[model samples]
Target: MEAVLYAQERSKETRATLNSLRENGNIPAILYGKNVSNVPISVEKLDFKKQFNEIGKNGIFTIDVDGKRQQAIVRNYEVDPITREIIHIDFLAVNSLSVITADVRIVLVNDAEGVKDGGVLQQSMFDLSVTTNVNRFPDAIEVDVTHLQVGETITVGKIRQQYPFEINHENDEVIASILPPRQEEEISTGEEQEPGIPENLEGREE
Candidate 1:
């Protein structure tokens, strides 16, 4: 999906200017491209929010700058710890002719057979890193764990057949595992020993 984002060229790169831009509700960002030149830009907070919310991070979108359009991906961003608002963003313009490496959301779906048998389900990886063409990148990778059993593990090699992209990890790498239910053991106490008193040794010396 593509999002319509409008950006402006940053006139200055000083802290004071950045602060004033923030006061005006604009965010500082940079756009890096392999084919296009890297440039510093600023975008309105409300405009960015509207596009971000619709396409989401990691989704390929088009950024329109001065009537020029560039296909890019939201590489990274910084958020305020307290306000949870986006502060800065970094974008990378993708070349449709080359393959790019990216992480795709990995979701474990369906009830595991081992879970009903008192087994605990554990996911080792939350995202699957893969290399694929820009237009071929998937939104997310879903894995079915309905056949997973206790003490059994699902490896990357097992689900490779379900995807077209090349996974950038070892085949034997573990993805998810089902652990047996934890056992409860009763605590056993040893016989208590009598406390030694200092006066007891003095009586023997007398």
Candidate 2:
């Protein structure tokens, strides 16, 4: 889960300089953390994307700037709205003993018994916020719904028993549920009124 990314120090923060870096296939980024000074740098976009795909957001890796390497994690990033390309990135320097807060994607595993019986499956939460050591961070949390029946729900309290990390949510918070067929039909059948011209104006035009 750990890999090294090479970067160069960026001396200028001007718009023109950032644009030039992007044109040269580099992504403008900043590295900072507790007790560490913020350093402006740029990394090769292709290399970054390759490493990012291997190590998810919660994975810890090393960033080599100039000749010095630091252990870091992906803190944040900005993407181009039009091109859907990453434009900027924020890296946080961390150590093995550091406890960081990260969002882990929630994955539903197995087919719910309710779904096999024609019940509609609804997921309320897509991810979970948790605080854990850098080495203990999980890429995603999987919840098994194989036995879930209609009218039943999976809650945060139920998931806590399976993982050791601290989840930053209330125990009673619902994650996923199954609705009965009747309720699903009612929700789908509630149609909105369509807009139409008035009868008096139907025969007239400007």
Candidate 3:
């Protein structure tokens, strides 16, 4: 799906002017890419929401500034803590041949064999940094958990072989693991980490 956004170039970068832009229902953003400095612009909130819902964050979209169109990807965005509204967004211009570095999700498919046997499933890693041509990178990576047994694990080094992109993670980093069922009298349990193979991950920033 193709999505396009039309934005007006912003010249007044003062705080007061930016606040006024937001008050008028526009989202202030910047355009950045290789050999390109940040270019400030603003977009109508309603138009942005409509197109964003169609193409999603990772998909490529066209940003038209005063009739000049540039292909770009959503690099990052910020939300207002008080009202939970989108405040600022950063866009990175991209080409189809570019090898983009982005976060792709990891999902477990099929009920684990261990989970069927009263074992717990621990998903420590939810997303991974992957490097691949923009056309090849997937929205997510699905891992088969049909055969995982108690005390078994799937690690970064092990799972990357099943995909096209290179997973930028340490070899021993655990992705998913099956743990033995918890025993009775396990205190300090409510609203906490899982009992066995507790989710342990020092997630990286994309």
How many clashes in each structure? 0, 0, 0
Which residue runs does candidate 2 get wrong by more than 4 Å? 182-206
Candidate 3 TM-score to native: 0.84
Candidates' C-alpha lDDT: 0.86, 0.93, 0.87
- Judged by TM-score relative to the true structure, which candidate is superior, 2 or 3? 2
Candidate 1 per-residue C-alpha lDDT over 1-206 given as tens digits, one digit per residue, 9 for 90 to 100: 45778888886899999888878999999999787788898888998888777765567778888888888888899998998888888988986685788888888999999999999999999988998887888777899999999999999999998888899888899999999998989787886767786665766854
Candidate that scores best on lDDT: 2
- lDDT, candidate 3, 1-44, per-residue tens: 66789999999889999899899999999998986677999989
What's model 2's overall lDDT?
Answer: 0.93
Residue 142 in candidate 2, Cα distance off native in Å: 0.3
Worst 10 residues of 3 by lDDT: 197-206
Clashes of 2: 0
Candidate 3 stretches greater than 4 Å from native: 186-206
State TM-scores per candidate.
0.85, 0.87, 0.84
Q: Report the backbone clash tally of model 3.
A: 0
What tens digits encode model 2's per-residue C-alpha lDDT throughout 1-206? 45899999999999999999999999999999998899999999999998898988788779999999999999999999999999999999999889999899999999999999989889999999999999999889999999999999999999897998999999999999999886433457567766898667897969
